[model samples]
Target chain A: MSNPVSERGFEPARHAELALLLEVAGTPKPGNVDRRRDLSGLCFEHFLTGAVGSAAGLRLAEDGAPVGEAFETAVAGMSKQGGGNTQFGCLLLLVPLVKAAVAGDLSPEGATRAAEATTVDDAVSFYRAFEHVDVAVGDPPGDASDLDVRRGSEAESALRAEGLTLSDIMELSAERDANAREWTGGFARTFRAAESILNDEGPVTDRVARAFIDLLTEEPDTLVVTNHGEDVARDVMDRAASVSDLDEAETLAEEFVAEGINPGTTADIVCAATFVALERGVPL
Target chain B: MSNPVSERGFEPARHAELALLLEVAGTPKPGNVDRRRDLSGLCFEHFLTGAVGSAAGLRLAEDGAPVGEAFETAVAGMSKQGGGNTQFGCLLLLVPLVKAAVAGDLSPEGATRAAEATTVDDAVSFYRAFEHVDVAVGDPPGDASDLDVRRGSEAESALRAEGLTLSDIMELSAERDANAREWTGGFARTFRAAESILNDEGPVTDRVARAFIDLLTEEPDTLVVTNHGEDVARDVMDRAASVSDLDEAETLAEEFVAEGINPGTTADIVCAATFVALERGVPL
Candidate 1:
């Protein structure tokens, strides 16, 4: 009999969606929502619903839709279940990655190329997606206040007048947003983490968790920096660096959830890494 | 701005896939795998992977593929991750439900019509799926040995000679398999359970878990009956009937997982009900 995986063929859209699901399903990922724990406002089920809801946008990306349109659609679909912005940053990373995967190259260079090709319309779409969910973002630098995501569609005119492509906007935010940095820097961290995930042993979820801890240890999470300042973010990273195994991670997970310290950006990067790994033939 | 949900439109394929995800994510559902628990050899991540892998087949059903073909394809894809039959029975119910939903009627009657329309080729496909996963099935009756599912594709000639459509085969197994009975009985139990799920308040996952306990209280689970016999199945029902709230159910969940008593058939029915509820507008 023919191999069923080959018979079904490679589905970049499904892989992207599965990446979102698997990212949240990984247990003891420290601070973020996972299978075993939930934050006060966010639960595991919201992530599940968001992953399913995002399918349409993922399909659009695979079909070669504009990055901004796919990202906005994914955000809107993800917010449809009212989980309150479960995977916005993850979707930002995935849309281009999926498009690149569909174009027969799923490398970081391919993803960066896809992101670089986005137009001003894509920027408008990306901004409009802000209306769908209450995403927590740091205040825009004074010079870019007119293009703040919190301004939603109100920023569209400024975006158009500035002729800022989604990639251009991402470049502007690269220093503050880990997700945006991937767009500008060829997704280096995402690719590196994907390699780690592929090289790790045990169930894919466990591998994802280990990779997540490694990533958290490597850098202060941007979301934590946004919410709790650099000091707290550095402290969180130090705690992450101390976790050598799942049991220690589980203890940290409980403390993080209890203290309301969520390292969301690191989780988003893990989601992106998961897509890359799956595209590179990570089983399950 | 256009309503994003309307902009994306109704996606029965996605709804079916989400049902599979939601079914497994609902916590404390007695004995089966859920967000917080897993039976021996079947971790929660396996179900997550299985749900993602089954998307291609769910899409096939929505696109009007034959019931048996879609089901077998789903089973093949689900087994791709080596979950060892994480969702074989759930897929059996979802394939027809998705087909029905795609046809503009997601009611039990519509599901029945879809199931009844399956061809002999679908039966051959159904038998062939057995080669993919080691499903736990009771021994076939002495007279039906030639059509045994354990025989896999080797029984195709017998199925073709007998001119057995997938629905006809389901009819023969209806008395033994709750999943088969849905095909023969217009999915009465599935619809009733869906109504219960929709009526319950709180998180959709909590609703699913409560509805699961309700369903288990109403009848002895067919898989439990197959594995542990009628007496044990009845005892399970009694225990389920005593669960008045989530806390009680949590206690039972721990006990059930420890004892290795998985009420898989009830879980399958709940999965089917989840699809129906989602189609009928269950939020998240």
Candidate 2:
């Protein structure tokens, strides 16, 4: 038991170190553009509770809701099997799954219990039911130094399933998405490069990251199109138009990592670059 | 104005379309290894903020603190520039960047007023700001829409001053590393991953989105060791011993993506595989 997997211990220090190296190599946000998982725990807390109570909650747009009712329209749309998220969305309705993971077996009592336990606490409790199951925790992120920010695979799947179904059950999913793209809409992205020149080629800042997220938001059919658009732009336009102050900041960040400098000094320089970009009001 | 940028009509519809797609695509919680950017508005915030404060609010990890106080220890070990994240951590700071077209050259007071607005309000304010600067309200996005995400090469060449002195900036210029092969702390990752598997991951019900976020939490260095180690094991260990069920999920995910599923769905399916792997608690 004491031994690491037969493969033995993996050096996580490598991530920080590579981050350090990337800092040194050129302070870019690194080639890997990370897409984060559902981190809006606060809303989720509310949504989960609503899911248990009313069996759903509104999925809002950056602007607000769409014209009509949230739930009825969506359930009708997703279940038709001809929609954009055909197989994926409807999977949530499988009563068997909810029974096994959420409510545990076919019974109105089970469904009621699931509904009752809809908040994060309920989700966590529901998650506890699977401890004996022989599933991997996905990427195996073994860091919980911080309670909220630590995890890998496992329970997320169940939660996602629960989330999907409840969302469908309520139908806020469609209404919430009332405003997608139209970056300048409610959700605008403002990116900056870290180099001396001002352009778009650089790390993923709020702007760049938002743009990326937006382009890929929903529509399974457009995945490749959005991805290719982003890739092409990153390759050609990034260097030509990245926000340079960002580039400079990255350069500084790289040096700090290579030298193993303290975190504070590094933060200041990064903040300053961001402030400059903020001052400029990065275009949406 | 009939222009889409104007809120009364044109722009809102475009946002609706984008939202429709994302709702359909499904940002399902993936099952495998992933990390969560646990902060409220790290990226892809459902709402909007003005350029200044928005950019300043972002923190890399939940634990991040300002440099002067939190990084005192690093300061001693490093130069005026030395501190763990002195230069680096600052770069991770997120800033709010309003587009020049949105709100240009406002006094700090004007900027602040605009900043106070919500996403929709901000967009409206920003669109008005464009008039102050030499800009057009350009047509709304459509099949032939051309709202450019690109900027001119020399947008800010005028902003730089000679001999800028940064106290603790991170340096990203290339250089040799002390260790021939980079390494770092891995025990923590090992423990976390193990604990997660024990805690989450189960059969038939794993989610995708949340798990991937958790997986991203481990220091990338740990990933190289664990994953690259598996890669290493494949070369040296029994061929069959190295392959994993997680691989199956990954393959499934790739196939899904190839079929033009949303990246979020690909992430979901792939993450599920990872969760399954962790739940099973195989290959360290």
Best candidate per DockQ, number?
1
- Give the top-scoring candidate (lDDT): 1
lDDT of each residue in A1-284, candidate 1, tens digit only: 23233232248898898899889988888888888787776888789888988988999998888988998989888986655779999999999999899888788788888988999999999999988888899999988789888889999999999999999999999999988999999999999999999998877889999999999998889999999999999999899988889999999998998888999999999999999998888865
**Candidate 1 clashing pairs?**
none
lDDT of 2 by residue, A197-279 (tens): 12443332433332222222222212222333334323323332333444443453344334332221121122222322322
TM-score of each model, paired residue for residue:
0.93, 0.20
TM-score of chain B of each: 0.96, 0.19
DockQ of each: 0.41, 0.02
> Candidate 1: lDDT of A81?
64
In angstroms, the error of model 1 at A135 is 1.6
